[model samples]
Target: MIRRLIFAFISIAISITIASSIKAAETIRPNVLFIAMDDLNDWIGCMGGHPQTITPNLDRLAKSGVLFTNAHCAAPACNPSRISVFSGIAPNVSGVYANNQVLREVLPDVELLPKSFSKNGYRSTGSGKMLHYIIDAQSWDDYFPEPASEMPIPHTLYPDKRPVSLPRAGPWQYVETDWGALETTDQEFGGDFTVSQWVSEQLAQKHDNPFFLACGIYRPHEPWFVPAKYFEPFPLESILIPPGYKEDDLADLPPEGQRQGPNRYFAHIQKQGQWKHAIQSYLASIHFADAMLGRVLDALDNSEYADNTIVVLWSDHGWHLGEKQHWQKYTAWRVCTRIPLMIRVPKNCPGLPEGTSSGICNQPVNLVSLAPTLFDLCGLPPSKVHDGPSLTPLLKDVDGQWPHVSVTCLHNPGDYGLSDNRWRYIHYANGDEELYDIAADRYEWNNLAADPKYADKLAELRAKGPTSFASKPEPSIQSLNKLTWVTLGDDKAPPSRPDGSQFPVFFINQSEAPVKLYWVDRMGQPKFYEEIQPTKTARQATRPGAIWQITNLQDKPLGYFKVDDRSAQAIIPAH
Candidate 1:
């Protein structure tokens, strides 16, 4: 009996010990407060890219952590850059180099950062625009405004009538590229402000497990419409043009570089004399974004998890306000590629037991390293498919040795911009190159690729670039190709002079009744294809010049669409 009792006591003790160890492990695991800013360059006060910019919250965050001064995005465009940041994949390998390309379609099997955290026993949650215009619900445990909506954004006020400040230059100009101040408050704005509020609520509560909370702030982007109070600090009369601009900046650039510069939007904005107004609006929008960030930070600092959470802040990519004679992103120049990156690790973390000290690191780093760095800091297994190395060494010590060169993928596969500590090299797909000694010329006003003395340096940087680039994935038939609907009058449908390569055209029947699909052949005669039910969609194989007609159930003419040189969607109008 004594032996049996001793054995039982030993078993109970072992069980209790195991439970305590597991509980202790859970308690020490660090929480993550991941924050993302959209189209935010180094204009914050900490980086000083623009003197008029006011970002007290951003500056405070920088003072509390390690700020990477030479960090660049994996891609310059939003869809590709955000995809690379979240997936730990580079745009060159993933073949997603543009905003229009769908993420799941291109790299369907790749696990996103939040999903990886969730898989490793963390509660991953987020709000606002984490992905390009999407929330990507399956990757998170729970999201604000409901995850089922698939759009993480809450309702925000926008201008009732667009083009409030800058007039539409042409049909080719993006509609959202306008700016003005709105007569409203942060509570009335309700976009990123709402996102911040929800995130603050999450941070206030205690969680059962470690949390990976992402707060995405969408501002300092386009349309630049924020509450009027943000614009008070930056008076229109005091607004200044970006100091990087020069009339002869493109004179020494290669053919591709010269061609990419001097865009029509900049010309139009200059012609309309709205340049200063645009700058003021941008500054205001940035101030608004900073205010939203302050809310989240305040919540975290006041919460129970304040001392144990890891805070990381990054932007998807930088924006251009007439830098390099360009107006928006999609360029490999430093103005568009370089972004603000800051990480603050608390004590008791696996990667840095002593925690991170406040300092700046000037090593060239890419955003693709973000996932792996978080994994290392949070004690999770490093992803097997990460393209960039972990940044834990730099986080631990700001001046740590980093030999990595940051590469920013451009619009195509073979085009890229490579950056190091002292140089910036741009390579276009058509064999044009531009090299700038960035240390001497921060604005990239001079191209030194043509200089024979730099030939060896050129070769060295070129060799460092990616050797193989995956071919761009073919666009799916469901591409967002918009077609204009011409309501039929007393005229007949146009002839289909079917020409060029064939592609699929998706037809959506948005009308209240069923519509008949007809192919207008070369003879201008309607050939019946099929009947499309209301609120249904169909695909039709068509050529570049093929004409399609839509008719009511009684065979009455409704509208017609003349296909362009690409596959598109033709929506039948509701009567």
Candidate 2:
């Protein structure tokens, strides 16, 4: 009896130890919900970027967590900014200055953000336009659609008569600058709505692994095509001009800032008398994006993992609407580089009981620190490659004196803006400079760099820029077949393929630069093949359904090549 009692006690102790270990592991492995937005600046309701913007969802989200009002992206373009966020490498070192360069082509073996989470046993899944393109499959465990497509929504919803490509009133803006409501249901509008729905379903369902759920909302970008009902909230007359606009803002600007400004796009909009209408479209798209955010937030609220998930929301870059007389996001101004960044750590989380506040963090931070911050939060091994400082300290204390200043770039060769808490100093490649003290000159109307009083501050900020930039590598072209055009919604290709297949389609990239090829297979589906080096002949068995799309990395079409039964190797014109 004594021996049996001793055995029973040992068994009980072992079971208790096992249960405790399991509970501890579960508590430490918190899930992450990463929300990404495209071309969305501080125009949300909370940031007061626009006077009449409606963004209750984003506002509520900020209240639920810590909001960083002074965050900036490393680069002002989508591709480079996002790459910097994921890779923890700045654009100056990576040399991915443009949207055309493939991330894999630029940094072959760099550790991506999602891959880091995945390494720590987190299941990373995403939907919609997370990256500039949908080609990096190994980074995420699963995507909404296949690995190659941007989103699951088909590319047939664009209005047939939309004057997007209509003879431009001026040569200032591209065809993508036009905007109007599609007059369709949210489901019919597709893209972001579908992406949100899929993400919501995933959140509600149970997963075997701790998840990193990413939802990318692509709107308020360009070709702002939300439903007409969204437009109803913001009538053209109700739309207000940008609040910080100054008529002569560019007068005191440096030559670089001057050249980037006064773009003909805003001038063209005024010339065509569509300034208010364009603003209305932008507001409507922002509202629609907020609705999508609401859907995801609601799903999370009702989800079982609500108490354990860390939610983070950010935009890739900001947009310009007559601010500095600019329209796109290629410039280095605050209107282009300043992005919305918010973080909500769950209650009873490890190292943080009830976590940090729903308060504002005013310290200047860069999006490049996102990866390193996430690693620290999850207790994962930190990376040594990140250039930006982690905000873990500021999250705990909102008013902590942060010594970091954000570095934002425009193009190559050190054309950048170094923004601290009180000042924004811009340096051009041609040795021109522009400085704005944000505390005194909130609108950046006055340039203070040339003033001798601020010379010490000017020299301090100028010393922070990268001493050298990595030279751009070999150029590659993007393919331009129906598959590629489908993602872009380019209506250049015909609705159907030509008759008579059973021919050989020969491809030769005439230019010295490498190119990409996109083609329809025997199964009649769109597929992408990227970074095909130049001087190689790829032959396709041309049947009745065979079609090809070919283009360089810079989006210059090499030529139009087709195959038919009458020819063995057909090379079409490069029109």
Candidate 3:
């Protein structure tokens, strides 16, 4: 009886000790303040990307933390880049390579960054454009503006009349490409301003558990519409053209690069003499975003969680302002790949006893590592499923020995831009390549791939790239924008006005009967492409301004959809 009592006492003691230790660990786990900026390039005061750009809050954040000067996104578009960050999976592996690709449809079983935190005893909440305009509702415990809306963003003022400053050249022009200042105050303007206020309120209050708070600032993305006060510093006359722009930049490029450059949007902006005005508007938007960031920072500093929280700021991807002869993103270039990444850890964290030291580190890093890094810092159990390695070593010591290269996947599979410490190599599926010594030529004005001297270096980077690509999953037709339907008696099928690069267009037949698909030729003559049966979809290669007409098996006209610049689904609605 004495022996049995001793053993039972020991067992109870062991169980109590284990439970107490677990509780202690739960108490010290750091809260995460995650901030994301949309379409923001390296054009901040600390980065010196553009000399005229001003970002006081961004510079302040960099001064108190470790700034990653050579950080790049996993992908160059909004949806894929953000998906990579949250899921810790690269676009090549996830098969989500464009803005049109939905995250849930692509990787439904994946545990997102916020969801991971929530599972491990943290409250995950966010507001404003966190996941490609949708809230990714299931990942968070609570979200500002409510997750039921599916849009976390609050209302902001825009010009009552669209294309306020830049006139649309044609139907091919993106409507959101325009820019101007709105006559309103930050409070009155709302939008991101409202997002910051809600996030700030959360920071000021006490919570039951450690929180993972995300604040997404959506500006510098498009339309450039902010309060007029933000635009005062950047006058149109003082605006200089992008320093990376060169008149003959495309001359040394391969045929694929040549075709991708010189897009219609840039041509139209230059033709309309709105290049300087556009630059001015972009600068203003950056400044506005910075001010909003300041509000959130101030709230944190005044709160009780200031010294215990881990702060990380990042952009989804970089933007291109006529760089490499390209106007926007979606190009395999440094300007579109590199982004701003910063992390500030308070003293006595689990991963780093001393916390992060303030300095800039030039080592190449990708945003895909964010999830793993946060898990390490918070003392959460390590997950083997993440594609990216933990960044804890770099966080502990900025100059720690590291052997990793950043990879930025393009819109198509097997096409990627890889960056090491000194060189950038772009590999396309067509077997074409671009090599640039980015250390010397930051602008990437010279293409060194054709030179025999750099052949060995090109091969080295190519070997490090992704060997296999996941087949891109197709988005459901119900998720796409419905094209306007016109019956036979209503209107005639428009002529095909094909222009620009070609992309796939999906025709979804929702009618009860089978429909015949035809491509209207330039002269308005219908040419049969294929037949799409009911409840079926057919993919066709088409270009901007192209027209596709639908008809019954009896050859009666039904409706037609004019193809835009991007890949979209056209619904053949039932009569």
Per residue, candidate 3 scores C-alpha lDDT tens digits across 385-464 of 67888888988778888899999999899889999889999989999999999889998999999999998999999999
TM-score of each model, paired residue for residue: 0.87, 0.82, 0.90
Candidate 3 ranges beyond 4 A from true positions: 1-27, 486-498, 504-541, 546-560
Candidate 2 regions exceeding 4 Å error are 1-26, 150-156, 164-172, 348-354, 478-575
Screening candidate 1 with a backbone cut-off below 3 angstroms (N, C-alpha, C), the clashing residue pairs are none
For every model in order, what is the number of clashing pairs?
0, 13, 0
For 77-128, candidate 2 gives per-residue lDDT tens digits of 8888999988988888888787656788888899888899999899999887
lDDT of each: 0.89, 0.78, 0.89
Candidate RMSDs in Å, in order, are 5.4, 9.8, 3.9
The Cα RMSD in angstroms, rounded to one decimal, for candidate 1 relative to the true structure is 5.4
Backbone clash total for model 1 is 0
Clashes of 3: 0
Q: Per-residue lDDT of 109-204 in model 1, one digit per residue for the tens? A: 889999999998899999988899877788889998789987777999999988788887544467788888788889998999999999999998
Of the two candidates 1 and 2, the one with more favorable lDDT, higher being better, is 1
